[model samples]
Target: MLDFTNDSSGGEPSSQAVKQDAISDQALLDAYSNAVIDVTERVGPAVVRVETGSKTPGARERGGLGSGIVISPDGLVLTNNHVVGSSRQIRLRDNEGIVTEARVLGVDPDTDLALLRADGARELRYASLGNSKSLRRGQLVVAIGNPLGFESTVTAGVVSALGRSIRSVSGRTIEDVIQTDAALNPGNSGGALVSSAAEVIGINTAIISGAQGICFAVASNTAQFVLSEIIRHGYVRRAYIGVSGQTAPIPRRHAVAAGVDNKMGALLAQIEPDGPAARAGLLPGDVAIRLDGVDIHGVDDLIRALDRDRIDRTLEMEVLRMGRLRTIDIHPIERKPSARQGSAP
Candidate 1:
């Protein structure tokens, strides 16, 4: 008779070790499944199926559609603008299979984000946005959306990478995009890329065709910024500053003199002529110290400070010019369509 618990000749208990390994493997798999299921259940109600069709005169009628996620209790939804594709006729279907008419409130082609309103519905379940900056590679994330017309389709994978840059169909650069290995189908656009805590960390938008598990989502931080601006202004009102800058470390003495604990500041690489900075008498070689009382830590800080509300508003800019600190109140104007935003040189 053969003893299954151990190797009889060596008595090493090989079978027991194998059994333990199998148990551990099974436990890990169970944990993964549970996490995906939890996130799906939590955000499922907010995930929506967006169906779009053209209503133009003498054009192809009712052709394109995509997924969307409700962002407000009042039935405001967020989706990819590319999904709507020149069609204002949108209809939303919630996880409960309740179909409702949706109106396009606003859309930003540059960011590929569009805002829609479900007709007269309130108290709808919405997703809580999370910080994408806190994401790390290999972190577990799940994609919940209407993939290929399958409503509430849930797929699970890890964050394959972070800080990726992808260009939208509108030729705008989308920065700080979250890349994941989750299987995304054609209709997964505008879905929720949720974290383990069931918070939306990114908005699923694009997937590499013919590639396996290569997908990209707009960062939740960017989505949050755009969503707020769209809700407030009916569009993303970006303030364009005429300077291209890179983050550089300021001298300890300079930092101390500026009363800032952060040693880094924006090093101007180029300044647009006749722009807000130039109009305010800001010259090249000036290191930004602060904008609107916010510490000048880096270029990203400056960009964050110049949101839609800052447009046409006078901001007290503190800068170190030629070793002398000076304050300039500059009024930034709304960025015109076709005006280079992101970082202008």
Candidate 2:
């Protein structure tokens, strides 16, 4: 991937002499346009038009249209959870006009990402996940999708913003979202938000109905995390230590001792008896300093680190208690679905 930046001089073209091998200003413009076309060709094969239908009798037979990206040559695909919600009968068509049945591997509403396995995949073209954290504002980006059922449609634009938060259809807050003015349409959901060099950086997810050029994609980083868990466990998992806490600042000495940035931590207000933290010698008034190797700046940080992969694992932790730093080992358990309402995780 190019990892492009919109750092060119604004207003006028550069005055520096163009080298023999260098592309001129006019040629640069043509090259830019051609590069986008090339990217569309390179990544389009991996972009699949997804059609999901409801199996409920007496209901609408035809489902809606969406897009998806082939993430593995063995036929694993990624798309928005809403696109495949409660619908196991999924059909995918690639650029070669090959339509095939797909099986739902998993669906995670919290991140609005779902995984599918296409049937009879041989030499399937797939897109490589890029580092969404490396994306810069105004960098050149292209989206390949079947917008409005127009298969393999291509649109080019710059990234509008990064680290945005959008609400998922399941009413969960999707963090670290990618905002782009790439002109996504109704069938563009779950399409590939590709970089200049054709790396898949994000999966197109949503658009503001009344707004033009404002679209959102689930960041590739988040998709990677969700896909890994879904592939391994058939569902997204979260960990909790059975404690009530809130974000709080840490004492200067304790912060220095724990090597935590921002001098902040999660201050525990209550500890359930025989809970992981309580059994690990954590007191109700203690402030968690870190989990594993991740520094805890707040309760959110602690929660983010306690993902599905963290369950059943004994993680080293640091806490500030009684004006002293202490080390603790906690084995976080899975947070139950019933306890998810306004509860700490």
Cα lDDT of model 1 by residue, 1-345, tens digit: 764564466666586787999999999999989988888888999999998874679876557657998877888888998887677678888888787888987777777888888997357899889989999999999999888788889998999999998877654567889999998998999999999999999999999889988999999999998888877877777787788887888888876776667678887777788899988988888888698888878776776577677888888998887666789988888875442223342
How many residue pairs clash in each candidate at the backbone level? 1, 0
- Expressed as tens digits, the lDDT of each residue in 10-75 for candidate 2 is 533334433523656678889899989889888989999999985578876688789999998899
Model 1 spans with C-alpha error above 4 angstroms: 1-13, 54-61, 240-332, 337-345
* Candidate 2 ranges beyond 4 A from true positions: 1-25, 54-60, 241-302, 308-331, 336-344
Candidate 2 clashes between residue pairs 3 or more apart in a chain or in different chains: none
Every model's TM-score: 0.70, 0.69
TM-score of 2: 0.69
lDDT of each: 0.83, 0.84
Score residue 96 of candidate 2 by CA lDDT. 87
